[model samples]
Target: MKTLMKRLRAFALSGIIGVGLLGSFPALAAKTTLTVGAAATDVGTLDPHYATSTSDRTLVAWIYGALVRFAPGSTDPSTIEPDLAESWQVSNDKLIWTFKLRTGVQWQAGYGEVTADDVVYSLEKSRDPKRSAFSADFAAINKVEALGPHTVRITLSRRVPNLLGLVTNYAGGFIICKKAYEERKDRFGRAPVGFGPFQTQSIVAGQAVTLIANDKYFRGVPKIKTINYRFMSNNAARDLAFAAGELDASAGLANKSWLQRTTSIPGAVVDVFYPAELTLLHINITKPPFNDIRVREALAYAISTQKIAEYRGERFTRAPKSVIPSNNLGYTDNAGVFPYDPAKAKALLAQAGYAKGLTFTMLSSQLPEYETTAQLLQGQLEESGINVQLQPVEHTSWHQMIRKDLSPVVIYGAARFPVADIFLTQFYHSSSIVGTPGAVTNFSHCNVADKQIDEARTEADPAKQVALWQEAQRLIIQNVCAIPLTETSQVWVHNKKLNWGFDLKGSMSLGPLVTEQTSFSD
Candidate 1:
């Protein structure tokens, strides 16, 4: 009887243990879903061509496919590799570029074949001022012609050494379908047509955007069936969502403390990348007080970048001495010209005839970093006898004010690119000056500086062009065009279980995140 009882107990225990093991196996092997959160201030417009803000760019990247995409491991973020375009060659003079399109690539909708004509149309429409695309980064293209079903030719007015780099940029050369764009012009931005691994499922402006797997994508469909991009208004809220497991990933992380706090969690991982964005103080040169170069220089010298970096946590920040970060190509250290000197600042203020000290409104957004920097500047300037009134504004309003050149001083962030042209051209070009209610350039209205910038733009030789850029930088520094502050590092927080190897750079590149090489593990 004892032997029989022992045998029965052993059998029951073994069965129970087996069942427990089976239950835990799934827990260990379950597939992970990554939810990325973005601190979006406003809802993005459905039109990819119309997107101007960084928030819109984040969403557009998933839905749209470019002719050539920036390779993940390239030293230069703007260097191009084959995407829709299999290969490309530039003429000896570098004026003309011929691109050979990849074969067997189809649109997500399977809406007929994608030909070179589609590329031509997309470029043409983007450059068309009538279309009013705020994102016309490729307006410099002289012309685009479809050579054949699989080939396209681009002619430039002037030789662009960084032509290929520009083409791979987020704003310049995203390819779209001609048929779909024409048919769904109104809905295309929300429901974009692309050759990416994912297709747009839905977009609710200012709220969330969703993408689903494109089974027919030439590179093969993404393993993840769906991607949801949720818009949280601020980093604090976004971080909270991530900690709660409501989000898998968060882009443009603004809070270092929160990120550090979350990394302690078992499934959390903090990914730090070199930020492509520079946090700077933009002085309105068109305005009265700031128009004086002396005043601008004084203001620039008043703020201490070293202190700002220290206070903000130096691990994710670096004091930037030039408009372009040191990591970028063609960047030269120009710190000597814009050295911090409180005594010199005060002297300049007196020389500018503001001996009684100057008081002006300094504008910044509600985000913690901007607000903190603004306050820090305020204190620093006050010591130099300059009273800076802190004006904290909403993100949308702040953008508008900066574009209109309404504020005396404004805190701004710019994502750095491989080529210096991207920064110098857009910000300093006279033609790019925003004049109306919603101008993109913030109406700096700098005509004299514009002429010098134009000369640099047309210069073809890389060495010559760089010399010109250096000259331009010196000129801007002399005029105190804008106070270059610091380069803000990009920090990404993710769930450790989802393994998508990505390096932190100045800007976020989505290509690697969606590539086949990216895989998840429990």
Candidate 2:
């Protein structure tokens, strides 16, 4: 509740900085600056641990560092490389791990040097549910102890499917400056400090968040001196802003029509990147109508994943192979899905005593991806005698409302660390059921696959782990916790002058990443 209040206060405080005033803080002649038009009305939070929105996550990666990180433009876990920790060693049993921290790494804004004590504090904070939205991801950690001023050791209660994934520069893996956080406390959500290439300079609430280059960055000093991450929720407005040369880069719509329209712009390059986000329709089984197995199965039969993929075009979207994303380890189409058949759907509804048809209201997001996906499902389900009324809300409100269990069906789309265990646990494990203690987005209140998910996380044998994950997916599908829809790749349009310092491929943050080598030239 306190966190919610803090967020509200931050938003309220944001109205003070008018958008027009951004011109007053231009970069020096020798330094370069870039303005990006993001698809958001405002930032949810800047603190990496609680940054869930794409807008916030995009900024989090810039302003924070983790023990390790996915290589620039890469989502593959095998590309995991050192960030704050110079090197690490793991015990043969895989429970105990020790890390050697890089010496003399400076923190942003005089926060002092990064040390083992800071790493230990950050890990503990990541483990505390009150401090982190991703605490469940750290449940296997027994403790983090500082062995020396520059060394830290982590002991785990049991082996996690991917320990490095948990500690990478994503989600709760972002390391925080202990002194800065302790000093800021609850206010740290808006004012975060880290050791990344960029530092939070200022936030103008509904307008933009300004970031300045961190000269003391360990990798190297960033070439782009300033970043103006502006909030332009309207697609047309963002496009216009980019066309007017007010934005160097902007978030792009995934549909082919939008792609064709934007590609004609002079010097505008559209980057459709890897590791597509998996969209799903999560049915709250505990809710009336959905509580009946026949009704749940009817929903599966009525919806068409192929149609959803086709809506966005195959170039950037594809039908998901399983409830788990195709790019994820252990993903298997053999889990089995109900084919789209209106006749079968109608029969199932008739058997469930709803022959006349059933009507239900769904609280969905107005965000392009979600709004379109929900409308598609609603139209398709209507043919099978299932009437869905969409109560569209803004993106932020939609996220909060669904977590309150107000939505019978949640149209959620996300890209996590390409791992099956992480996806299955957060979406199907009983422990992750929303509105409960330690919840992490189990919107459906799914519990059937909890056993398999738990066993798979601790399974040491590679083949056995894969089998357990496959079994879990099969169970979740049979029970109809969620119907997998389309997997859509991220799309963004950037100016030709912007150099990202790496070949852009994929980002776990679901957006482009700016690093020390990033710069702009005529």
- Clash count list over all predictions: 12, 0
How does candidate 2 fare on TM-score?
A: 0.93
True-vs-predicted CA distance for residue 393, candidate 2, Å: 1.7
TM match of model 1 to true structure: 0.87
Q: What lDDT score goes with residue 403 in model 1?
A: 64
Which model scores highest in lDDT? 2
Clashing pairs in 2: none
- What value does the lDDT take at residue 395 in candidate 1? 67
The digit string of per-residue lDDT tens for model 2 on 1-522 reads 999999998886775565556679875454389899999888888889888877788899999999999999999999999999999999999999999999999999988899999999999999898788888899999999999999999999999988999999999999999999999998898899999999988999889999999999999999999999999999889998998889999988888788888889898988889778888889999989899989999999998888877887887999886888888898898888889899999999999999999899999888877877888889999999999999989888788888888899898988888889888888889888999888888999999998888898888899999999999999999999998988899899998888888888999887899999888875
Worst 10 residues of 1 by lDDT: 503-512
Looking at model 1, residue 509 earns an lDDT score of: 43
TM-score (all chains, Cα) for each model? 0.87, 0.93
